[model samples]
Target: MFERFTKDARSAVVDAQQVARAAHSDQIDSRHLLVALAESEGLARTALADGGLDVTDVVARARASIEAGDALDHGALAAVGIDLDEVTRRTEATFGEGALARAGRVLRVRRKHIPFTPDAKKSLELALREAIRLGSKEINGGHLLLGLTRAESPGRRVLADAGADLERVRRHAEGASEAV
Candidate 1:
């Protein structure tokens, strides 16, 4: 399957790992893949741009998801009588400001070769299926984007949250794949 990927498609996969690492995530998921696709030129970028979604915003969303645990869940913990804010305040007071964030940064320094989450693997598989469905000899970035839209992953959720028209993106990606 990898051998069938176009250069842009392979680059997107490599860049997705970079995106995951930048987000301080231990594993790459579709959100990271989507960010990679959005940043890269070609059918995926065009499909996202046509939907009025900016690349910066998409990357930000993926980062937020991956780094969600960087900060304690104040509200949820507060409901359980664990005031994370108070804990942070006291910890910071004793350890100096931004101590927790510094620790988080240290812990986030992952080694090379971050692995993909199941959803990411599934999305890539779906991308191959998409290429086959479209009768394309090789998988391109557009097929990857279409795969993301079809999968139930954080990327798909972010796309919807960012007000991307899923059907519109699909149509545009399919059309664009033909031209590739």
Candidate 2:
């Protein structure tokens, strides 16, 4: 299936892996893919922009979400009346800056391989379907973006949070693809 991906689509997939690694994620999620799409220059990016979504803001929010999700024991300690901010500050003073975040990154890297999350996998599969439906010979970034909208995934959530209308974005992609 990947063999059918255009150069831009292939690059977006590689970019998604880098995004997942940078976020210290155990798997490549839909958010990572969305970030990749937003960063890329193509139909996907244009569609997002046309829908009134700012790519930079989307990337920042996605990163924040990843950091929040990856936080270790902050909520649990807070429940016990412990201030995680103070703990982190003291720990950083003793060990070094970003000690906790660094430790988490190390652990995440030690896994050697990060697989795609189920939602991400589904999005990729749907991308293929979208390409076929559009009568395209190869899958492109627009198809990938459309696939995210078709799936119930973090990518879609990010788009929604950024005030992008999925249907409008889809139409823009389709119209752009026809023009191409």
Candidate 3:
């Protein structure tokens, strides 16, 4: 699965792995991948911010949504008043039309269970491509930290609007690394 990654994507994966070690996790999930994508310098971050979003907030929301779902299952979506239409609107608002197109390409390469919505995956892949294009060998926590900046999710936009210093947090996460 890692082989499909471009050089920058591969580096992002490595950075995610290192971050996972630091976080004391066992595998690379989309949250880690989101952080990796943010740390990598690329369109992912640009598109996200351009559309008005934040990566950290996106992750936080994802966690919250999942926790809510864990307790409420399908009912959570109804109880929380979150709808696919709202999600779609948010995705378009945060990523722009180009991001959606790019995400489609990425979706073609991903597995069925990556957890990310099509929009998120597209943003991630584009971000990795941007990172590689910028000559970054590995995506770091800084890149992942930038996920909020690149994401096209609604919750993330709220965070960005709140003026979070996502880059600073990502830097801290990267700076505090442990050996894998």
Q: List the global CA lDDT of all models.
A: 0.85, 0.86, 0.47
lDDT of 1 at 73: 58
Which one wins on lDDT?
2
Q: Regarding lDDT, does 1 or 2 come out ahead?
A: 2
lDDT of 3 by residue, 1-180 (tens): 334444555676666555444443333455555555555564344434443456556555534433333322455675788674566568889998556446644553453332444544554564455345445554433334343345555324434444655554434433331110
Give the runs in model 3 whose Cα sits over 4 Å from its true position: 1-62, 69-115, 161-163, 166-180
lDDT of model 2 at position 85: 97
Assess candidate 3 and give its TM-score to the true structure. 0.35
TM-score of each: 0.87, 0.90, 0.35
lDDT of 1 by residue, 70-175 (tens): 4455567878999777787898998999887667667868466678989999999999999999999999999999999996788899888877788988898898
**Per-residue alpha-carbon lDDT of model 2 for 1-180, expressed as tens digits?**
999998998999999999988888888988999999988899889888887778898888877776667647688889999998998899999999999778888898788778998999999999899888888988899889988888789889888887877898888877665555
Residue 105, model 1, lDDT: 62
RMSD of 2: 1.9
Better of 1 and 3 by lDDT: 1
lDDT of 1 at 7: 95
